[model samples]
Target: MDIFVVDDERIIAETLAIILRNHGYSAETFFSAEHALASIGKSPRLLLTDFRMGRMSGIDLAMEAHSRIDCSVILFSSDLQECDREWQMLQKRDSRCTLLRKPLHPARLLQQVRLSLSTEPRLGLHVS
Candidate 1:
């Protein structure tokens, strides 16, 4: 599946992209929501964004992505409290969005990604 990794931290973005690529997934890294949104038309299967990005937040990205593409979104934040509202909003959307705490265990993150992508039907494009 094609995935977009958006994080202001270059290392984090590149690392996640590398891990996704190693697992046989097509992944790209972006430093901002704007850059990531530019590729939404490509219809990536997943959007992995940092919750505390400088300009545009992950919640905003998720909302825009839901409108523009069929993809599951995984929002990562170091502060769990900061994610509470966004998590609730995601649950309301019912569009397969998940909140992932930062400083994540690589293996655990991968597992969650697998679960989110599997349960999220919109990630796959319908040819018909």
Candidate 2:
């Protein structure tokens, strides 16, 4: 998979995936982090996941994906404060994670995706 768009909200997840697909990239949608985790690691892929979700938060999934496949992650949430608190624990020089707020524009999402995939190592936490 080129990218995994995960969110508890079905519409958001699918819509993001569709947008990515329309942009000429492979994309998949998962309604829960667990489902996405189960399907990952055949190869490293980028992840665009909602920060808060069932069973596991996006940060939790990102940590696991990094450990398993060194995947890049883009975590989004309406709850900015909570996302920030959780993300602070994971920031490091070699980390490849980005945080975005909700109501994300399609242009911005595409921009982030390009940026995330264009680079290999991403240091610090990129928030927008």
Candidate 3:
């Protein structure tokens, strides 16, 4: 599956990309939403974005991306207290999207990714 990761934090983006790549997935990293959106037509299977980017928020990125192409979006944030708000907002717009608290357990992240991808009908992640 092809995954696009967007984050102002390069380390986080690269680390997630490495993890996804190790799982035999094609991953792309973008430091900005604008840069990533430029290639939105490529149709990534999933999107992983940081919630608190300085210029453009992840929610905005997801919205823009989803408008261009159908995909599953997982929004991550260090502020766990904001999770409920994030979840509610995303669910209102796209239920297939998920909000994950940052400093996430790698195992849990992978598991959620597996489950989300498998269950999402339009993205075609083919988790098996």
| TM-score winner | 2
**Per-model TM against the reference:** 0.88, 0.91, 0.86
Q: Which regions of candidate 3 deviate over 4 angstroms?
A: 83-87, 119-128
lDDT of each: 0.80, 0.83, 0.77
Ranking by TM-score: 2, 1, 3
How far residue 20's Cα lies from its native spot in candidate 1, in Å, is 0.9
lDDT of predicted model 2: 0.83
| Residue-wise C-alpha lDDT for candidate 3, range 2-116, written one tens digit per residue | 8898899899999999988888888899998888888888899788888788787888888888888878888888784655565566667776677777776778778767766
- Model 1 clash pairs are none
In model 2, state the lDDT of residue 106. Answer: 94
RMSD of each: 5.9, 1.6, 4.4
Q: lDDT, candidate 2, residue 61? A: 88
**How do the residues 19-50 of candidate 2 rate in per-residue lDDT, one tens digit apiece?**
99999999988899999889886554688899
lDDT tens digits by residue: candidate 1, 75-127: 88888785676667666775477777778678977886787678536332111
Backbone clash count for every predicted candidate, in the order shown: 0, 0, 0
